[model samples]
Target: MADLIFYTNPQSRGQTVRWMLEEVGAPYDTEILGYGTSMKEEPYLSVNPMGKVPAIRHKGKVVTEVAAICCYLADAFPEARLAPPTSDRADYYRWIFFTSGPIEAAFSNKAAGWEPTPERQRMFGYGNYDLAINTLEKALTGREYIAADHFTAADLFVGANVNFMLAFNLLEPREVFVDYARRMTDRDAYRRAQEIDGRLIAEMQAQQAPQPA
Candidate 1:
């Protein structure tokens, strides 16, 4: 078995980690789990009690959460150059966590039709969907990369969100966001990861389709 094991569902946020893994050029094994089934039962739960997809077990250590997995892989495979040097990781840590926290929270809340009132904005880290998205747009305005001059794992996480949000109409099609997402996803690694997941999704959908009696 490969030292790196990736547990994921193709339709889930696991796609982001899949891109990161391809960028790292590591030989990892993928375990496709279904929602509310294997993902919520047995040994998978032990790996991540949250019963989430996109968990990675590297060597012996297990890392869950999408952003965390991306960061871990970058550090674990320095040769991939997916992370800036430890001393030069100010923006790296900044943007990655920002996306993981406030941005994600804002998007999720917005999708669920629950935007906080202006008076209660202070109580929420993201304030509101517009506030969070505008911040991200400004950060990427003139930058080709989120964390450094070159691509990093931060881009993978942030870009995946941007791409997904834009695709689903969850985010407005702002010029800056569109340009940044294009640059981040215009990579061989990203394409390969998407193809893998796309095929998996198709297979899963076919299996779930009602049979023609």
Candidate 2:
């Protein structure tokens, strides 16, 4: 068995971690779990009691949450250069946490048809969707990558969120966002990850389809 074991469902946010794994270029085993079955049942639940997809167990250590998993994998396999040097990780930590926190909260709330009122904005970290998105747009306005001059684990997390939001119409298709997502996802690793998940999704659908009598 590989030292790294990935637990995921192709239709979930697990796709982001899958891309990160491909980028890290490490051999890992995958365990696919269904929505409310194995994902919530034994063994898998022990890995992540939240019953969430996209968790990873590396050398007996378990890491959940998409951003943390990506960060862990990058640092665990430094030869992949997925993280900037520790001395130069200001933006790296900044953007990754920002995306996972504010960006995530803002979009998720917006998707659920709940936006904080102006008077209650102070109670929310992102303030509002426009505010959060505009800040993100500026971060990527003139840069090809988010943290370092080159692609890092931050880009994988941030880019994956951006691409997902845009795909679901949760985010606007601004030129900057469109261009940045294109650049981040253009890598061979990203393509390979998508192909793998795409195939898995197809197979799952095939199984769920009813057979004609």
The residue pairs in collision within model 1 are none
- In candidate 2, list every pair of residues with a backbone clash: none
lDDT of 2 by residue, 66-96 (tens): 9999989989999999999999999999999
Q: Candidate 1 has what TM-score?
A: 0.97
Clashes found in each candidate (C-alpha, N, C closer than 3 A): 0, 0
TM-score of each: 0.97, 0.98
Best of the candidates, TM-score: 2
Q: After superposition, how far is residue 210 of candidate 2 from its true place, in Å?
A: 0.3
Model 2 residue-pair collision total: 0
Error of 1 at 130 (Å): 1.6
